[model samples]
Target: MNVSIPTLEQFREESRAGRLAGRVRLQLPCNLTDFPAEIFSLADSLEILDLSGNALSRLPDRLPELRKLKILFCSDNHFTELPRVLGQCKNLSMIGFRNNRITHIAPEALPPLLRWLILTGNQLSALPSELGHRPYLQKLMVAGNRLQALPQELSLCKNLELLRIAANRFDVLPEVLFKLPRLSWLSYSGNPFCSHNEQTALADTPVKQIPWSSLSLQQKLGEGASGVIYQAVWQSVTPIPVAVKLFKGELTSDGLPISEMAACMRAGIHPNLIKVLGKIGDHPEGVNGLVMSLVDASYRNLAGPPSFASCTRDVYDDDLRLSFSEMLSIVSGIAGVAQQVHANGIMHGDLYAHNILLGQNGDALLGDFGAACFKPTAAAHSHALEKIEVRAFGYLLEELLERYEGEATAGATFATLTHLTALRDACLHIDPTQRPVFTEVVARIRTA
Candidate 1:
């Protein structure tokens, strides 16, 4: 799955042999200060173009020459604004400008068919109303900005499913957002909706804090927007093995690391969750961290992250198919975990196939509390927020059905899949009040 990136020399050789003209992908990092005119020759067939890790300031006016280009990545660039020329790319749908100095976006800068847009880690205070008119805009990442409010027009994007607006200056989430038909995945932590009391709760909670000096760090297991996770040995009296997450402590696209730590501790341990052992204490650099039980090696991610074309949905392999029994078990396990976490006054904000780890016989564990938020157990909107998460669960269930092979066989497995699909549709209703709560979802799946 690792595609080697062609170097400048390799591209030059290919260009000389007339090979570049027919190629579908062109990726290079040549520290460009201006657009590469050489790419225009391949305009007839080019589909994906990656010029990331460059010093480019602006795109050329003739960028529309690449009529077939659909995906463009300009991340880690020096652009002060998103190039308006991008709108001219008639076929361009997915555009990424992450980690740029971009502060301005022209009204017509977006392509007409944009489905996925990544503008993370930028300096934008506002977005153009024209953006809301893109009917196909499904995935949007505007985290790490200084925005005070979202354009109500964005609610008009009925197909929008995944949205990241964390670490912004918003005092309240727009009411229009809650009514979007397909807004299943969302992150609004670090906004004013996140309670100030949650910060005090973490400090006042009576959880055990383990000293950092007592642990020996080993190989890194994984990493995310907030922190790096490592396989470490807790040098206790018995020298036990454990997983340690060292938080960067910076405001991430999801929220603050401290908030994630507090939410994880408050979630408490459940059979289908990653068990938190304690908090890391007395680090030399004073970094916030958490110690948790190491997950077994037999577990692996259920699916890959969303692709450019899928927008908000996770991508599964063509051969990845699950049986009726396995599908039911995984769904029930996750629903049970969500129900428990909600009862403890926490919402796992980022629930997706990528966050789930599957073991032998479909045992599932839901991890990654980076996007989790603390909710008042009796708040009026608490029920609505939980229902929003249920819609996310419906999306997950629908993906499972898409990969299920039982429908064609037409038997008990097919019947069961059909019933579950009905439940998923009910959960995904546009009206939040109509969707079943996690407890109800669990009970229905269990009875089946």
Candidate 2:
């Protein structure tokens, strides 16, 4: 669905005629060189203000005048620093400054109520220690930066659940991250600590190489931040249909595209994973891609991506409800797949409902390697990494349980719920060492 953005002239006219008053959301992507003074008129009702794709370098000192603003996006701009006045907006909870030239953040730049913050594709060498002061922060994206370390105080953010520190200068994993109690989703693939001869890991994976001439591209099936997936026909003797994922060869909020492709190549085949058939060779545009078995048409995403309000959790359909049996099957399939993936020494970093597809009977296929990373060779590091992902699975299970419409107080259904709840608790243990391994989780779920 295309959302029509108001043109600069239209917005100016609306502001001049008092037509924008009481508007809760406003998006103006025109090549703006200045923060529109007219926006101040909507201070009474504006909650979302998107000024992305503009040429602005600074915000007015009175930005806090928009007392009701809750979300602000100024990506694709030229700002060198985060406006300190943003801290004065008591209600501002989400801020995105992606793809900006920002190199510094003032100590008072962050809002007190910040829950979601995006600084992807910035030039910052370090982050403000004051970041740890935002108790409400839950999701943070600081990929594609130059930072070598994180503030030790960040461990104080107990509610932080999802974090992306990929493509940075970290020589080792920050010890502070392990202290985050609710960190369920994490991606740190392209840093120096993990990037040493990473390609050699795929040397033993005997995946076939499928040339571009052997495939016929049809229509785009989907597109994510890293690549475009197409429904294509493999022009072999049998002309079988397949899904082709072509990488965009750029840094994403999660990590680099080459990292994702490498992870997918190393994932290999599994019943619950989208089967990777071969690596695309000799593309006309020299693009890197993967050919995978096409999923059945009946399969659909289990849930939608996180919303502005949900921040780190997936959002489900309002009418969606699952019975105990269906929920069990889905969770069981995912757990089984996760067991196999971790055994192969890969972490499905972005393990969430949005990354899962479900069939009518509740069979699940886990897709998307955009946030995946290989485990470090060290036994201790690998174990801790896997445990972090275990928490992500726990959250997924919790979400499904919340949507379960089964008989909670009855016989079999109640027993099943009790069993699953215990499994979720085990996975969500605050101490990574206490969380059950995927092997144990799979075994427990099977017995349940």
Candidate number with greatest lDDT: 2
Across 1-448, the per-residue lDDT of candidate 1 in tens digits comes to 2122446666667677776667788787877777757788888988999999988898999999999999999999998999999988889999999989999999778999898888988999998888889999988888788888888898889888878887778776567667677887777666666656467558866678898889999999999978999999998878999999999987676677877888888887788999888898798998989999999999999988877667777887778888777788899999999999888777788899989999987799998888887764556667877888899999889888777656545676666677788999988898878999999999888766
Q: Which residue pairs in candidate 2 have backbone atoms (N, alpha carbon, C) closer than 3 angstroms, thus clashing?
A: none
Off by over 4 Å in 2: 1-6, 202-204, 408-412
Residue-level error in angstroms, candidate 2, position 23: 0.2
Quote the lDDT for 373 in model 2: 82
**Pairs with steric clashes in candidate 1:** none
Question: What's the TM for model 1?
Answer: 0.92
- The lDDT of model 1 is 0.84
Candidate that scores best on TM-score: 2
Q: Where's the lowest-lDDT run of ten residues in candidate 2? A: 1-10
Q: Rate the local accuracy (lDDT) of all candidates.
A: 0.84, 0.89
